[model samples]
Target: MVSLLKNRVNIASGTPSRIKKLIDIEALVLSRLAVILLDIHPDVKGYSLFTLPQVRDEFWDLYKNYFHQRLLEGDLRICLYGPLPSGNEFKGKKST
Candidate 1:
């Protein structure tokens, strides 16, 4: 997701903070989930498939909390699209 981060960094360049903490947190969570899934279930594919929505929700919450204001439509759209496996739609899914 380097490209996503690059785009975000470029967009947020004019903002006060040099680093995007929310983006970083989202990336870290995704990476850690990926590594764990891969290691524990080497034969299992599409494991990363399940965590996408959680990641999106987490990012959204972070953005809302950190910014303490509603994101513009365009910014919200960008944040939504940056995460992988588009249209995560986790509603009604069972949790372990």
Candidate 2:
């Protein structure tokens, strides 16, 4: 997760509206990238990401500071799924 607003602030270069637009752009690009990757590799059901504990904590802090309000009031939800531990193909997987 990129801290667009904080980074801008650190370098002294962001308005509230500008930061909002940058965050939105990043979210949109990441969403689209997921779709594109799925299309490119049908066997790739999804991705698993890991982070250092400190980084994970920082991410939550950033999320609380920036996105908590929008998440509570807006139509947004987090979805998680369990991919097969043995990879994408099951014993009797069907072919597309």
Candidate 3:
């Protein structure tokens, strides 16, 4: 996913895709953690992500560090929403 972020730092250079990953990508670190701990992507309970009583409690710090690093290095964009307003025209999977 780091590669995805690297390739999308610029909004003007991108094309529309099947996945709408802007807002949800904000909490991407949690999804990474969830995948590590539960083999899932949902947070389960991200309310206290910073003060978790579990082994993955450090994940929040890691996420924050990576985010800041990306910002400082200009590897990610502050305007992650890009040229669109976002989520208003979502093309999510059909309800089955």
Candidate 4:
């Protein structure tokens, strides 16, 4: 018996190359913000943008203190947009 399949290659055997582009941290943040606001595919959570040692210091300074605050506020807005539960909902619940 012969198989009709042609060129069955093992895709996992190949390794990818690292191509790093040095971009201004401010510009990178702004472009990411634009993509998020515009409802682009593969959103912010899908990326790991800051990995290079050259941008580590600047990335932490801009992201951890500034960008993180903005993201938290955005989350707050989304969280508060729905009907919230009242204390009455927990009247019969016991603390475990």
Tell me the whole-model lDDT of each prediction, alpha carbons only: 0.35, 0.37, 0.33, 0.32
Error of 3 at 12 (Å): 22
Q: Which digits, one per residue and each the tens of the lDDT, describe model 1 over residues 13-54?
A: 211121245246453332122111111111144434235455
User: Which candidate number would show the highest TM-score if scored against the true structure?
Assistant: 2
- Sorted on lDDT, best first, the list reads 2, 1, 3, 4
TM-score of every prediction relative to native: 0.27, 0.31, 0.22, 0.26
Q: For candidate 1, what is the lDDT?
A: 0.35
Model 1, total clashes:
0
Q: By TM-score, how accurate is candidate 1?
A: 0.27
TM-score of 2: 0.31
Number of residue pairs clashing in candidate 3, backbone atoms closer than 3 angstroms, sequence gap of 3 or more or interchain: 0
Candidate 2 lDDT for residue 4: 56
- Looking at model 1, residue 69 earns an lDDT score of 38
lDDT comparison, 2 vs 4, better candidate: 2
* Cand. 2 Cα-lDDT: 0.37
Q: Per-prediction count of colliding residue pairs?
A: 0, 0, 0, 0
Q: Select the stronger candidate by lDDT from 1 and 4.
A: 1
The candidate maximizing lDDT is 2
